[model samples]
Target: MRDRPVPQLPLALILSFLAVSGLLLLEDLFARPFTFLTGISFEAVRRGEMALLLGLAALLAARFVRRDLIHGLLERRAGKALPHLIGDVASLFVLVVGAAIIMTGVYGWDIGAVVAAGGLSLAIVGLALKDVILAVFNGAALNVENAFMVGDRVKIGEVDGTVVQSTWRSTTILTKARRLVTIPNIALGTASITNFDRPDKSEQRVIEICLDYDVTAESAERILLAGVIGAAGISLVDAPRVHAIRLDRDGVVYAIRYVIANHDLGLSSDHAVIKSILAHLRDAGIGVSYPKQEVVTAERRIRVADRTVDRRVLVQQCELFRGLPPDVQARIAEALIEQKVQAGAALIAAGAVRSSLFIVGEGLMKRLRARPDRPGFVEERYVATQAFGRRAFLSDLPHPAPIGAVTQSLVFELTRAAFAGILAAHPEIKVPLATNLARSPTLDITHATEVSALEARAERPVAFYLSLLDAIASSEANAR
Candidate 1:
């Protein structure tokens, strides 16, 4: 390397120099008599050195400002780092004072009397601010002890809010309604602080549901578990078990032991679990205890498409369908076939023909499939009750997936062909279906590869296509 370039001085340093020069120029103008009386260059040298120190001070202040040191210090203190902050400020003050002393001493001035007087004045000031001094000491002690941090939801006596700031003299709390209250640190440190966010060995949420004592505990438990699992932001980290604590005057009290995700509101999870439970109980002829009494004569059961059931009871059980427009649900009900999947049966096979969509009425199924890119791929899946599949009916293809019974599964099967015919027969249904499948293909076909596999997999084409044919035939029959 031929030569290294020197870095340019900062603008702050240049401004500092200008300020110091102005101070020195002003001193020179005022100290003319002192300069002549001294017979020495004291005035000139003092002016020069004082100018330098003033420039240095300006430079230091500018550096602090640019670095955001003051801002950070204030924020840290506000965020309950007061003791550490106070220590930092004290250290900086001492260093600056020491430097000033050294600079003054070097210029042949006596510092002993000045230091003694300063100490005396500081002691007198501290006595006057006894409460403030005590508060600062308390803050320092609290910082050393570190009783709590910012963002902690705390309660002290009647007060409750998040710890927003802890300063040398006071601790500030921001309440839920965005109100700020300052408590002197001396008082704050002495008070009992209850930190809500503190980690506990066991955490539980209590959900109070008053169901009639006539309802079995088992049913209540099932309902509670469903609600907990369905709610979003709910962590089943703990066994989501419900305990029947007491048969209070109100009803059966259930303490639902549920963990939420890190202090988040789990209203969705709660709602889902509760809804599922209530639906299940209603199906079982159990009712949730609410302050009400009503009596109505049982509606006469009538045979609709060879199945006799109360329409009102059916409506109440399927709350999921309740959200559907009355007309749409009526169409679905009309198209719905009472198809059943027996215990240990093959409902649908992966990579086979598809025809009807099946919605679970009862029981569980295991879904199996290969994991792609794995050596010697294998199938795996576990599905419970309330699962639905529509690809088979829609595509008119071989089951594109396989479902095996874990337990006997009863289901409502909607055959695509049957649904279509039902729509055509019932002009009212035509509008909605037409709207839903507006862009859908008129006909769905199976993959050639799956078609070939179907004959090999089953004894006959008819046997393999029983489900698909059944669906189509039902739809055709409904239309007729």
Candidate 2:
């Protein structure tokens, strides 16, 4: 991949050769002309050539020192390599030593005597560049301590971002907003820095929510935990924590904390958790509380549209009934039992056989998986317009998980007996219904191995429904 072959001679050797050649060429071309025009001696030309050689030698020595002392050792260690600041300091030391040798050997100049004479001037310059000196020292300390490295996500005072570059002068940070911030090394050394990507790249984020006073601590915790588990980007290795921090006049405060595998995903993960929590609460018919002013309010009767018309509209929106004819849709709607469920009520118990599908009309519902070993439950939330209990109704299998209400909810319940009667009366819709069910992600035949075994004993229609239910249950298990 390299354009040029590796040099046989060292870089210093090559540099020395070039320096000598250039000096000889310069002397040959200009030495006699300058001696004649300016009446200067040839000896003066030799001295100038010697000084140029000494300067070149010093630079060459510095390069060798830098490569040997820093780059050479660092490259071999890979990720454990030391910072460039140390190499820079080592290179500078080499240059200073080289200069001292040049001064004393070439010109018979005493370096100590020169420094002694310019001590006052040196002090003035040192004072002027105090900040730069301090920064360099701080950078050195930081490198030695191994505080943080490039690519680390850190919060240093008001600036928060991933470190792009770290040097003797400053540390560069690239923020989420795409802004680049350069912080002086001295400032970084003095300030308190929180490194999210250090030790490990995982970070814990807290999602705070306020719920109505009616929600119990146990139910609230269950809902919060379920919401966190359902959210993507959350760390499954660590169980999420929910705390009821305070109770106010308006509501109860909850803090849901979970670990995210990546520090960069903190904000997005929090958003997902919030969305999931809201959905779960809505499914359970739970409402969030907000501060409101009290007034002498009077109850007034409000006019609403016909229940049959509303149910027909809802059935039209449902995926299962969407493709059905208008008359079939009306028949399904008529069979639906409109029920109002209170918060904390169980809609369906785990392992209980059910023959009805429940469609959410308003509010939230949580599906909880019983964990006998843990003494608590794992939950998933469904919101408005969503449907559950399809597998139980279709296959006549026990409910995979218990469904509970988080808030006061309104739902339309459709019994399998009612649906079966409709199917018997109109056999033309059976094929269409089966076709639609076949396409569902939760009803893939490949995942329903258990249902295949049951097919030998049960009738064709019954076996198909059982397989679909098994597939749905398998999918839910895999999701968790």
Candidate 3:
């Protein structure tokens, strides 16, 4: 369109120009005036057919061959199909050049004045709409460079969003806030762009973990790495990593970095990774460390260590002991010994003779049973304050399955000798203890009196108590 010097040039101008020679040949009045003004020295100017032949040849070349070659060249150079405006410009330039050749070569006219006028007009347009022209060129260049495609998430300057459309003058972006933003191509040309689509769609993120300085770097890394790996939506191909940031007064700070699926899952994916880290921390028996100062206290009979749970608390957790007097409970608590086990370590072995009653104080203890038809073992987890080994401690029965530490854990264990002392001082404890040992451990005995009151509950209570006493006597023999 720019190649046309006249603001209103169209098919009518081309048609009127093609008919000029016919009218010149038909009437001497028109011919004489055209010849004098244009100064045409055409040897065949009097022939209308000659003018038509020249016009047809020019039209054929401009319409088919020249336009195709120009469009093909532009597309190949840009490595993509260019816009419709670019093709239209190319076609119009070809038409204008053909008309110029006809005017100068065929008509014997001087075109210097016409070229000068067209150049001056173009200069005026270049100065007036320079910003718009620059934007158009920038848009073309952006496509050629393959900087980013429509629908790609990108950050240009302060605007971060997905590109909705790219045009000759500007690009439209849809932000996360659901607002539409139109940015000029000139701005994109000057700004730095971060395209999420490049390299891959996955995004890299991080979480921080702090642990007591006493924990080895290797252990911290292993546990933290396991936590990140256990989370879903993580890209294992990238492989998660842990780095030590710095050593604090309270502990060592570690950064856990992992790659997830995409930018859209940002917060939800991070939350999953965090949950995994917490579970692994518990399993590893490592507490997240924080700043704390030790304070000296008065009237202390060796105050319980911050890291250790009170044994009395473990004793009170047991259903049988919870019903007993505090002094009687103290006797059992005094005899209890604190035992620690690391993750995956066996605390109770299958078929091993049970000599102690144990209560979990911290972390998890799990029982593992071999599958009847499968090769692997199934584990059932037991958490804090849950007691185990009542059947083993009250009778001579052996542990049916292996119990291991699922996480770093503490268990308060009351051995046969310690329990024997409590039973000796409190013989009435044996009735319920014998009942538990004689019946299925899974039975929920709300009252330890469930067995002691059997005399009233059962039709033949005498036979039941006698048999219960035998089991109690047998249990006492092991304590001895």
Please tell me which predicted candidate would have the highest lDDT against the true structure: 2
Q: Higher lDDT: candidate 1 or 3? A: 3
What would the per-residue lDDT of candidate 2 be over residues 1-480, giving only the tens digit for each residue? 112223233766567758776766777676778788888788877666676677777776677666654556454555444456777888888778777777787778988899998999989999999999999999988877878876678899999888777778988899989999999988976799888877888887887888777666655765566566656555544777889998877889998878878877777878888887876665444656667565636552221112323677667666666688889988998999987677679888789887788876655577765443446554555545567787677777899787877655567899877776676556566556666665553421121223332232322454474455444444445555
Local lDDT at 289 for model 1: 66
Highest TM-score: give the candidate number: 2
Give RMSD (Å) of candidate 1 vs. truth: 12.2
Which is better, 1 or 2, measured by lDDT? Answer: 2
- The number of clashing residue pairs in model 3 is 0
Q: Which ten contiguous residues of candidate 3 have the minimum total lDDT?
A: 1-10
Per-residue CA lDDT of candidate 1, range 374-401, in tens? 4332332222123245445644657645
lDDT of each: 0.54, 0.69, 0.65
User: What's the CA error at residue 221 for candidate 1, in Å?
Assistant: 1.7
What is the Å distance of residue 68 in model 1 from its true position?
3.0
TM-score of candidate 1 to 2 decimals: 0.50
| Candidate 3 runs further than 4 Å off | 1-116, 232-237, 282-480
Considering summed lDDT, which 10 consecutive residues are worst modelled in model 1? 440-449
Kindly report which residue stretches of model 1 are placed more than 4 angstroms away from their true locations once superposed: 1-18, 21-67, 70-124, 142-159, 194-204, 232-238, 264-285, 290-480
